[model samples]
Target: NYCTPYLGYPYYSSHDEMIHNLYHNDDCMPMRGFYRWHIQDPICFDEDLKVTIQQIGVGYRGLFERQDDVASVAYWYQAEPHNRFPKLPDKEERWPR
Candidate 1:
């Protein structure tokens, strides 16, 4: 998705005033930002769905598998009559520390 970096531009521009640069060290080498492609590329699934991401990088040596710490969150929309989501405990009970 690098080719279509979602900067919230009018078209396909790289004007990044929408998203904050979470990590951008070494001349945009090890760059990382919160990317959203739901508008541009919406995926449609019928029944079940699974999401996965791979850390791949390209450098002077070319494309290679990368090992990086990654964190992600996913949200989905369902049709009507869907099963209700289980209720969660209070914040104090959920995050007892």
Candidate 2:
């Protein structure tokens, strides 16, 4: 025979209270659960040019999913120009077409 309380444990604790107080006082962006493991070499950007592939519409969603896949990232990077944003140069100018 086993006995368990339906109420379970207390909802609020000292640590939780402290954390909530501190959070309310500070202006900080709460951490998100979205994360990706790096599987390829980091993409190097030119400081002078400062050109980046900014995705428009629903394109950003695919970027996070392909963060670990080198081939996919490359493909996306190359396809950036042709996307709805079309920030990058023409397809013929870039590699991995």
Please tell me which predicted candidate would have the highest TM-score against the true structure.
1
Off by over 4 Å in 1: 1-31, 86-97
Tens digit of per-residue lDDT, candidate 2, span 1-97? 2223421222322243335666564454332222232336544554332334443333645533222212222322343445375488877888754
Relative to the true structure, how large is the alpha-carbon lDDT of every model? 0.62, 0.38
Q: For this target, which candidate reaches the highest lDDT against the unseen true structure?
A: 1
**lDDT for each residue of candidate 1 in 2-97, tens digit (9 for 90 to 100):** 445654323333344445665532233233555466866878888688876887989899999988656666677767998898898878897525
What total of clashing residue pairs does each candidate reach? 0, 0
What's the CA error at residue 64 for candidate 2, in Å? 18
Backbone clash total, candidate 1: 0
> For model 1, what is the error of residue 65's alpha carbon versus the real structure, in angstroms, after optimal superposition?
0.8
Q: Which ten residues in a row have the lowest lDDT in candidate 1?
A: 24-33
Candidates' TM-scores?
0.46, 0.16
Model 1 lDDT at residue 3: 42
